[model samples]
Structure formats: C-alpha cells, structure tokens
Target: MKIIRVGEPGLERPVVVDDAGTSFDLTTLTADIDGAFLAADGIATIRRALAEGRLPTVDVSGLRQGAPVVRPHAVWCIGMNYAAHAAESGAEPPTVPVLFFKTPNTVVGPYDDVLIPRGAEKTDWEVELAVVIGRRARYLDSPADAARHIAGYTISNDVSERAFQLESSGGQWSKGKCAETFNPLGPALVPADELDAGNLRLWSRVNGEPRQDSSTADLIFSVDYLVWHLSQVAVLEPGDIINTGTPQGVALSKRFPYLRPGDVVELGIDGIGSQRQRLRPA
Candidate 1:
C-alpha cells in the first residue's frame, strides 16, 4: 500500500493507494498517517480492506498531496553518503555516519516552489531518497532488522545554497541548508513492503537538462545501516524522516553552474514517484 497525505497544508488527510491505482480515504479511520498507524498493523489492515472491496477510491488529481507524513519530529540528513558527492564536496569519507538536522518547519510538499532567497547566488539542488521511520529503533547492529523499522520511502530535493553552506560564518553548513522551503519532500510515502528502498534509480534535472542521476545502489551507507547507526545515538520515533544523501551530479560538482532565477527542478525515484518544483525569486 502506498500511504499519502492530501488536502491543504494543516487540513491534510491520510490516504492509501491500492494496486489498482485507486486512492482510499484513511482520514475517517485514522486522524493522521504517523508512527501510530504504521505501528498498529496498518499495512495489513489496509490491504485487507482492499481485498474485501470495502475501500473507497478518490481521484489523485485536483487535491494537493501533502508530504506523506506531517510535521516529522526531526528531519535528519546524511551528507556525502554517496562517494562521488563526497568527492565533489571536497570531503573525505567519514569513518562513521555524518549527520545534521533540517528544522521540521523546512518541510514542504513535493512540487512546491523552492523560493530562492534574496541575495542568494549559490542555490543548488540534490535528489535524495528519504526514509520514514515506522517504529522506535535504537542501537540495533544488524542491517537485516533495519527494513522492519521503516514505514515507507519518498522522494526529496535537498535544495541548498553553496555560499551560505561553505563561505558564510566561516563554515557552518546549516546557513546554506536551512532556508525556508529548502526541502520539498514527497510525492508519496510508499510502504517498505510495497517497494525496494534500495536499488532504485534516482535522478534530478534543472530546467530541461539532467544534472544529478544515480542509483540507490551507490549509497555509501545503506538505509538499514544508517537507521541502525542513528538508533545507537537517539530514539528513532515513528514519523521521523532521514534524507539518505545525494549522488554526485549536483551543481556544486560542476565548476560554474548554479541555479538562477526561473529555473525549474524536476526530481524523482522509481516506485516512490516524482516532483517538479519551480525556482522563484524571493
């Protein structure tokens, strides 16, 4: 089952899409699609409803699809999890996972306009696979158990500004990463059972040209290990999201290419879905 949120901003509702491509309302059944739903045998119940022909179908068009999950407690990110990206960023592969935070408010639905901040000259784009936590995970060493803790997967654009990221305040990356509307998150949150979080092809294009393109197989740390490693340091709550990092083909990788005003960014991953966002002047 592919779980999603639809409606306007705060009024979003929980929904599930069946194999027939029909969307059923899960709002009346669940207030929101969060850790609780994923925790209480949600996938099985939805599948059962579909089998019984009791599920309702709604057109996916018209209504705005919000991020598959709402206000995730934390938005954790891994920088340079892709070897090529690490090389482009002029950073060596870390001995362990390198983590950072994107404020929860930075979260926005897929296809939303990515506002290029005023005076920004280094705005960039990154196509990444985001992981949604389904259960409380902590200190698990085995990668095999990682899949069990994942609720679903989604597409993400880890938009950034190189100047604020590398040159400002000496070298704090958050300055470049935390701009409003920086992270455009999901087209949908596909259940882990329904899709392969690893091994899918991912790509991002600017205007009409390809820029970033790679497969999840290129990830330095697989989703399972990243989750397990993170759990060792903190509680992995339901509804939390982790951006597994981007591949090498970013603007930062190019010698002199960067997004200017009026650039459109299209990004996607197979199975999860795709999103196209316009870059607007702030």
Candidate 2:
C-alpha cells in the first residue's frame, strides 16, 4: 500500500492507496502522516483498517499533493554512495558513508516549482530514493536490525547549487543543497513491507530527455548499511528522512548544463512512483 498526503501546503490530509489502487480516507485513523503517526505503527493500523473496511473511500481527483510525510525532524543525505557518481565528481568512493543535511524546510510537494536560487551558477538536479524512519534508531547492532526502523520509501529531488557546494566553500555540500524548495519529495510513500528498497531502477529526465539512468544496484552503500552506520553516529528519530544519494548524470559532472528557469525535471523509481517539478526564478 502507498501512503499519500493531499491538499494545499501545510494542511494535507492523510490518505492511503491500497493494493487494488483504491484511495481511502485515513482521518478516522490519524490526522496527518507525520513522525508521531509513524512512530505509533500507523502503517499496520491502516492496513488492518482497510482489510476491515473501516476506512472510507476518498476522491483525490484534481487535488494538490503534498510531500507524503510532513515536517520531518531532519532530512539526511548521503554523498558518493554510487561509485560512478563519485568518479564523475572527481572524488574517490569513501570507505564509510558520507553524510550531510538539508534544511527541513526545503521539503516541498513533488509537483511544486523548484526555485533557482539567486545568482546561482550551477543549480542542479539529483534523483534519489528517500527512506523515512518509523522507529527511533540508536546504535543499531547491525544492518539486519534496520528494517524495523524504516517506515517506507519515496522519491526526492536533491536540488543543488554547485557553486555553494564546491567553489565558494571548501567542499561543504549543505551550502549548495539547502535553498528554499530545494528538495521536492514524494508522490507516494510505499510501506517497507509493500516495496523492496533495494535493487530498484531509478532515473531522471530533463525536458523529456534522459539524464540519469541507473539502479539502486549501482549503490556502493546499501540502505541497511547506511541506516546501521548512521545510527552509530546519530540518533535517528521517527519521521526523519534519508536521501540515499544519486547516481551519475548530475550537472556537477560538467557533462550537462545546470538547471535554469522553465526547465522541467521528471524523476521516477520503478514501483514506488515518480514526480515532476518546474524550475522557476527565486
């Protein structure tokens, strides 16, 4: 089943799309799809409610879609997780996970406009598989224990400004990463039990032309490993987000031009869903 949040910004109502592709109201079960709800095993509750016909059918036609989960406590990002992405950026693959953060406020709806930061010379797009935390994770004993902590998965466009990422700073990535509307997330959040996060095909397109075409199989660091490794260094609270890094084909590689106003970017994963965004001036 896929969890969806719909309505105007900051006022989305929780919804669920069942295996049969039916949309159901989750208001009787929960007010919103957020950290508090996920921490309480809302996915399981929703599953049971649907099976029991406790949820009412809802129409999502012609409505605005919000990020599947709202106001996450944190948005964590992994860098150089794909070997080819590392090589393309002139960096060697790290032995350990490389981590960073984007301002939580950067998160926006999948169909929202991504603002091109002022004076930005290298605004870029990165399509990544995003993991949402369900349970609190701290110093997990092993990668095998990570499954229970993950709520589900979705799509995230890790929009960036290359100058702030590389030239202006001494390689501090967040400066380039956290602009208003920098992260466009979701269309749906597929429950972990419903979708396999590993080995899925993910790709990006600009104006209908393919840009990034790769699979999670190309990741040098797997999802389980990233969760466990991160738990050791930081307390991962429920509703947190982990952007599992992007594959090659980012403009930072100097092979393609950076994003400009009016550019249309479409990114998708095989099963979970896809998202589209229009670039506009900040």
Top candidate on TM-score is 2
| Candidate 2, run of 10 with poorest lDDT | 190-199
Residues 99-132 of candidate 2 have per-residue lDDT tens digits of: 9999999999999999998889899999999999
The count of backbone overlaps in candidate 1 is: 0
Residue-wise C-alpha lDDT for candidate 1, range 32-76, written one tens digit per residue: 887788778676677788788776777767988788888888889
Residue 67, model 1: Cα distance from true site in angstroms? 0.6
lDDT of 2: 0.94
Those runs of model 1 whose alpha carbons end farther than 4 Å from true positions after fitting are none
> In candidate 2, how many Å is residue 248 off?
0.7
Candidate 1 displacement at residue 169 in angstroms: 4.4
The runs of at least 3 residues in candidate 2 whose Cα sits more than 4 Å from the true structure, single-residue gaps closed, are none
